[model samples]
Target: MKALQLSAPKQWEQIEIDEPSPPGPGEALVRIHRVGVCGTDLGGYLGKFPFFSYPRIPGHELGVEVVAVGEGVENVKVGDRCSVEPYINCQKCYSCERGLTNCCESHQTLGVMCDGGLTEKMILPARKLHPANNLSYEQSALVETLAIGCHAIDRAHVTEKDTVLVIGSGPIGLSAIEFARVAGARVIVADLSQTRLDFVTEKMGMTDTIQFDGSEADIEKLEAMTDGRRADVVVDATGNHHSMRRAMEMAAFGGRVVYVGITQQDLQFPHAPFLHRRELTILASRNALTGDFARIIQLIESGVIDTDPWITHHAKFEEVIESFPAWTDPESGVVKAVIHIS
Candidate 1:
């Protein structure tokens, strides 16, 4: 078996590993077909992601095929193509008891807390695989990425009446924009990268956008777009401390602000009085729920959510060591990058 591992910061190594054994009870052996690269992977590559560990096989967004199922496994069978829900949670935790498995106390996301599916095959719980046989391997690989946006929009309770301002036009931010549009909300995207902004407007059909200048003028521009009402729901997906801090300022009175992007640094916002006056709702959205994965798969299969334009780059498993570093550069214009494992 061959696998790509991040041996250290800014270093990638391809090495041979023993093939995985047959699945145990309630488990499934899955051959990885595709791996979607996201900010987490980029963070790990640069040694910035908090949960990432060295010498890790970094792949969580996966499209896989079941090779075999162990005894007592029924959710999936051999030959089924599926999307892997990479969040491995302890069912006995407090969050799990309340059906909030996305934030279980002992949650271990693949590619972060543990070794992941960057290799040819691996074994995982059968329940984590959501079959998407009708969709392409590329579409299946994008489910987990889109589910992040889906879950964030769900957290904000966006609707047609709301005006959503999504900060950052990266993959995560784009995911939120897609769902917000599906909900009939007027979605406006903001990003510092003109290339990304152009990609969203031109390729994604999103006309409303702000080229963030990192000034109060940017808020003024947003106000101009929303008829001075500002955003009814603001989603900050930049994972930058400054962007997260500025998110609250973009929301309307009594509006909701959902932080889907994360940063390990402590953030301090000095507008306590302003926050109280607006009576805003602030939420921290974590990983997606199992239901989100199923919903995204169905959405893609139904053509309600298009995956055609999401992937901007591709590489085979063996080429990742040479190509991965370039994808980390924002100027590369990589909205989403996928590694073909099969």
Candidate 2:
């Protein structure tokens, strides 16, 4: 088997490797069909993702087919199609006790914390697998990313009537738009690039789009969009510290702000205003839980989610070395790029 292995920071190679064995008890050996590339992979390649380590098989978001099932794994069987919840959590933690499995004290994430799906096969805990009827492999690979939007909305406690602002037009940002809409909020998206804003508005049917130029007009337009109250909820999908910090001032008084992006710097918050006025809730939404992965599958199945344009690029496994760099550039408009594994 040929797997894209991250041998070190800023280095990756398509190295030949042995295939994983059939499932052990409570596990399933899955043949990976599609592996989605995201900012994390790029960050990992650049040696920027916080938890990334070398020699890691870098993939998590995937569409996998069950090739073999371990003893006592009755939840799924050979030939079943499923998506994965990439976190392996310690079941006894306080957070896990409260159903926040994603925050379990000892958390191991595939791709980053251990060898993952950037290969032909993976042996995963059966409990972390989610089954969907007739789900496409490429689409299944996206459930994790889309679940980021769902998780952010979950943390925000957003209702159907809230005014939400998503501060990015990339895949995660667009995902936030969908789940926000599903939550019944009038969604608005912001970005520095008109091209991304245009893609969201013209093609994605997002009603409000703002060009973030730090101009008075942009702020005023945002104010007007929120009926003079500012955003009731703000989701920063940019993963850039500057944009995320600015959102503290952009949200409505007493509103919630969710940071879905990963950043390396220590973030600062405006004190006086942030302290005096609102009962502001600042949340950091990380990886998806198994349940969120399940919801993502259902959302896609029920027509509440459309990932058609999200999968904007594809490459054969052999072409990853040449293709990875191009997919990293914003100029490529690469929303979601996938590698097909044999």
Candidate 3:
């Protein structure tokens, strides 16, 4: 089988490798159709993602078709099109036992911790596959990214009366905005890129936008938008540390803040006044649960969520290596790039 392997930092090579065998018990054989490229994959290419190692298959966001099934596989069968939950968890862990499989004590994420779906075919546990019969292959591939937004919104328990501020206009940030709107919250978006902010306002029906100038005036603008009160629910989808720190101060008193982005720096916050006085509820949202996947599929089917403009770039498997660098450049206007594998 042919696969794109990250041989080292800033290096990608398409190479032939041995094909995975038939699915074992409780697993299914799946043929890769679409692979969504995200920051993590780009981080791997730049050797910036934490704990990422080289020679990785470099894909987790997948839309696939089942080719065959092993014994005891029941969730899906041959010919079913599905989206994969690439986060593998140990069912015996305390977190998993509590139905918090996204943060299992021992989590192995595909494409990061192990081999992933950038290849032509692979065997995956049947339970990780979510049926997406009503979705196109590109939309199915987006389920994973969209699921992150669903999980974050689920964590915050957003309500109609709340004012939600999403501090990024990237794919993940856009996902947060989408679900926040579904939750009936008044949505506000902030980003350094005017192009992304315009897209959010024009494409997603978001009217409030904050073009971040890295000044206190930005917060003032947010306060003005909310009638002197900050956002009731703030989601930090920009993994940059400065933005993450700013998110803490952007929430209103007694508001909820969800950190959906990951940063490597040691983040510091004032304890006595800011966080402590506000009585804020801070949450760290990880990968999505199985229910999130099901809900996202339903949202897509019901036409509540649209991913049309979200996908701004596409490439064939053979073209990915050469085309990837341009996607990394902010000027390329890449929102979500999906590679067709078959």
Whose lDDT is greatest here? Answer: 1
Model 1 C-alpha lDDT per residue in residues 1-342, reported as the tens digit of each score:
999888998988888999999899999999999999999999999999988998898999999999999999988989999999999999998899999999999999999989998999999999999999999888989999999999999999899999999999899999999999999999999999999999998889999999998999999999989888899999999999999988999999998999999999888776665478888899999989999998898888888998999999999987888898899899888989999998
lDDT of 2 at 19: 72
lDDT of 2 by residue, 156-244 (tens): 98898799999988888887888898889888899999888878877788878889986667668898777688898999999898888
Candidate 2: give the clashing pairs: none
User: Against the correct fold, how does model 3 do in TM-score?
Assistant: 0.98
Better TM-score candidate (1, 2): 1
Q: Show where candidate 1 strays beyond 4 Å.
A: none
| RMSD in order of candidates | 0.9, 1.4, 0.9
Between the candidate structures 2 and 3, which one is better when assessed by TM-score? 3
Candidate no. 1 TM-score: 0.98
Clashing pairs in 3: none
Preferred candidate (lDDT higher): 1 or 3: 1
Work out the TM-score per prediction. Answer: 0.98, 0.96, 0.98
Q: What's the lDDT of the predicted structure labeled candidate 2?
A: 0.86
Across residues 1-342, which tens digit of lDDT does each residue of candidate 3 receive? 899999888888888989889889999999999999998888888888886887888899999999999999889989999999999999998899999999989998999989898999999999999999889989999999999998999899999999999998888898898899999999999999999988888888788999998899999999999999999999999988888888879999999989998889878888767689999999999988989898999999999998898898999999998999888888899999999999
